[model samples]
Target: MKRIFIILSLILVSAAAVSLNSCKARDKNVIRIGLNAPITGDIPKVGEGAKFAAQLWLEDIKKAGGIEVGGKKYPVELIIEDNETKAESAVKASTKLITQDDVMIIIGPFASKQAVPAGGVANNYKTPMVAPWSTNPDTTKNRPYVFRACFLDPFQGPVVANFIKDEFKFKKAAVLFDVASDYPKGLAEFFKLAWEKNNGPGSVVAYESFTTNDKDFSSQLTKIIKSGAQILFVPQYYNEVALIVKQAKELGWKGTIAGSDSWGSAETVKLCGSDCFGKFFSTHYAAAGAKGDTKEFIERYNKKYGYVPDDVSALTWDSLNITKKAIESTGGLTGDIKKDRTAVRDALAKIKKFKGITGEMTYTDSGDPQKCAVIVKINNKGEFEFYKSVCP
Candidate 1:
């Protein structure tokens, strides 16, 4: 009888121990947000800027006693994983964040290449995600759980095409895009459709494609030059744009150069130097003519990071605020992860009038953001000068 009593007591003690440990395992006052970023790769600067900007937001929220949810507040804990600038790497990082870290939501993986795979993982697990700087539509097209902070390429491509036509009064445009990559290809298609539809069919003088990692654009440039294009639109990354501009100059085809946000980078100036003068790209915001929230953002960012904020930093900063606002609206998690994710998705769908520092935005049913695109010229000082602000 004594042995039975002892066993009962042991069982009760073990049960109590298990309950206590399980309670201690969860804080109940912390919300985990996964940050999937390319922190260690070719364009680490973008990830560095994004991380720095997010840290600033984190500090602000911490000091404010965390983000409010259902009339209460929960401190957010960020689980950052490096995507390493590869789609396969992003898939692994995103899976780890969702399955291992059990993060409630995710932010980042800046480019579409990273966002596409990371978004795939997020959808596979029913995790809500927001991409900051990725403009490709495929990132969020069919995925209701995925959204974006910036305008889509469909919106931006038209903005650039119209801006070039209206402001410069030039109609003959040429597209030289990286055929292997989706961002440039998608933008080129959008630009072509808009340019032709608005200005007339066949306004585009030339349409050329080049594979990725192709250093020589002479053949493509030769085609564009021979086609009599007044403005050369190369919707490619800054590195590739720099090379194309250099090669174009070497080929002695001196015409106006225009591109999309992928061309907006300090490194573009560093690489192209005076060769990029008078060239412009459609982007989020520029430092020299910023105002209101954008001005304050640039000032604060410059103070913290010792440099001006780029679109990646600006959009990442806004992505956090947008997510926090959605969580607040949805009251964030009733302990049912699946239902809570759905709630977050519904909240995101209804997110309108979000006054982000990037701009006031409204998320459409298609998960596309309605936002303005700012055109900035690379001045001789190698700084982005505000040229125009185009609104939808």
Candidate 2:
């Protein structure tokens, strides 16, 4: 009889253990956020910063006991994919995240060329996406599921043009753009129109183009130099920017070189060496003298990592927080992932005033962030110094 009782108690204990595990599993739920980055191609730093920033954001969320939705707290899970800095690769990565991984939100492929194609694939599944660095206007066009954290090329281009024309009095400007890249090409086009309109017609001294694989910029820089341009604007990536600066300096071109946010990487200085000093670029934020949330983020990132966070890092951090806010605004994820996803999309669209580490952003109805741009100068120390802020 005692043996029979012992067997029954053992059976009860086993059943109770299984029940406890089931309850714990329900309590320790998770929501996956997909990150598509160009972690292997020409501009790997962009992706590296983004991935690091997401990890930092996740750490904070975990400390806070995860993101609360519908009164249930869920630990945020990040699933990162390498896009290889190409549009086709971005499409493949984003498709996998949407279909196979079943992530609710996806953050970035850095540039517009990749973001546009990735955003298209995300649109089909009604998945929410926030591109931290993409500036091309076409990225969010007619796509409600897609959003960006940076100012559009049109918005930022005029800021750079007006700053040079109004503040620096640089009337004669020239442009060197990558013909194959959408961000640089669109920024160049916008800058040209704004320069001519704000400064004067024919103010742009020369317009030059290059491809992404082109290493020899001497041919293009020679034309820009011969045009007697006081300000040479090269709205290209940091890799190409470094080459352009090195080649231009080697050619004895003494003009003030300016560029877009793509020039915000530390690789610019490391690649161009001493030639990159004192140049200027328009970006989302300047970390060296940042204040408020920006200051706090830079300090924390530096403490955890070995270096300071750049524009892309801050944007990626903000995008992750923005996604978290959207998830929470939906009252937590519902059992129906489809309905909850739509709710998250709707919540994101309604975010008009979002104060982030970068700056205060007001999202327009079209999914663009209505924010200002900051011009940063590379000091003699190869550090980004906050020069000035331009608001629209």
Candidate 3:
């Protein structure tokens, strides 16, 4: 009787262990993707766009019965954490996503200010992160795990410089940027280098700056106009873009204004109104005259969201799809988070060419994509029209 009792206890213990292991295995059957966006801060519109686009992508994944890997389908979930558009906030958000959420991959913190800091956390944690619209080179510089969906400022700077020189025939240029911010500051320097190389040394007549959240630009505009600048290049977000452009015009500065991808937001023209009409800016894609898949995305987003999608939205969509491709290309998940994340990162690095709705991207060693930049003209209707394409 004693022997039989002992045997029954051992059998029950073995059954319990098996049940526990089975539960653990079942827990690993779902893939979690993290999103760290500025959902409630300075650029809430950017955050809104990222969230909306991600949800749209998630819908597609669900429709296909989740993402398939190695002939097995794993249900996917998105863990969204708002970064609030601050550098420190981004770091904390990314850390939580990696350590607590245990996400396979992270996407967003769109602006360079947030993306740069968040990237460090992701890289240190050995998690893959993709920034949808961060154009600063430092966002991916020396960080193998960090990647961006947009062109770097090094490429964008020269593109803007050459465009202004060739199209407008402008020899003297003025630049107004936010010194406190990384994106504008870096692009300002690069543009200056490119402009001086194309024209002559000291060709940039005026280089003025302001800290973030400064509404008045009369002081900078005054200096720029006094410097005999024929064009004013403002590489700032939509909020600052409208203020700078309007304040410049109000101050009796009559030179053409040009912008960078930051101006591609729908709020730019809306805030600046007729003041922003007939301006040109360098961006990822133009929504006014899109075709094929690009047009389809824009139409669907507009119908569902009640507004035209911006470059950030398009890039986020592309980034998620790229993430999906990389995850699917991992052959199979080992039910180990670390191993699977490494596999996804490796697959992403090996992806040389990907056709995105924005453009075709060829990944480089540093994980930056070789893609073309589009010059968009803000027409009379405040619509972003495709003007020209510049390639690297």
Top lDDT model: 3
lDDT of 3 by residue, 7-64 (tens): 9999999999999877744368899999999999889999999999999899999999
Give the clashing residue pairs of candidate 3, or none. none
RMSD of each: 3.2, 6.4, 3.7
Q: Candidate 3: deviation at residue 144, Å?
A: 1.0
* Index of the highest-TM-score prediction: 3
Looking at model 1, residue 67 earns an lDDT score of 83
- Sorted by TM-score (best first), the order is 3, 2, 1
Residue 105's lDDT in candidate 3: 96
Specify the poorest-scoring 10-residue window by lDDT in model 3. 20-29
> For residues 1-392, could you state the per-residue lDDT of candidate 2 as single tens digits?
99999999999999999998676442225788899998989789888999899999989998998888888888778899999999999999999887777788899978898999999988888988999999999999999999999999998889899988777888899999999989999999999999999878998989999888999989888989999999999998888888889999988899899998999987888888778899998999998888888899999999998899878999999898888888888876665566767888888888878999888887766678888899999999999999999999
Q: What ranges in model 2 sit over 4 Å off?
A: 1-28
TM-scores, all models, native as reference: 0.91, 0.91, 0.94
1 against 3, candidate with superior TM-score: 3
10 residues in a row with least lDDT, candidate 2: 21-30
Q: Which of candidates 1 and 2 reaches a greater lDDT?
A: 2
Q: Give the TM-score of candidate 1.
A: 0.91
Clashes of 3: 0
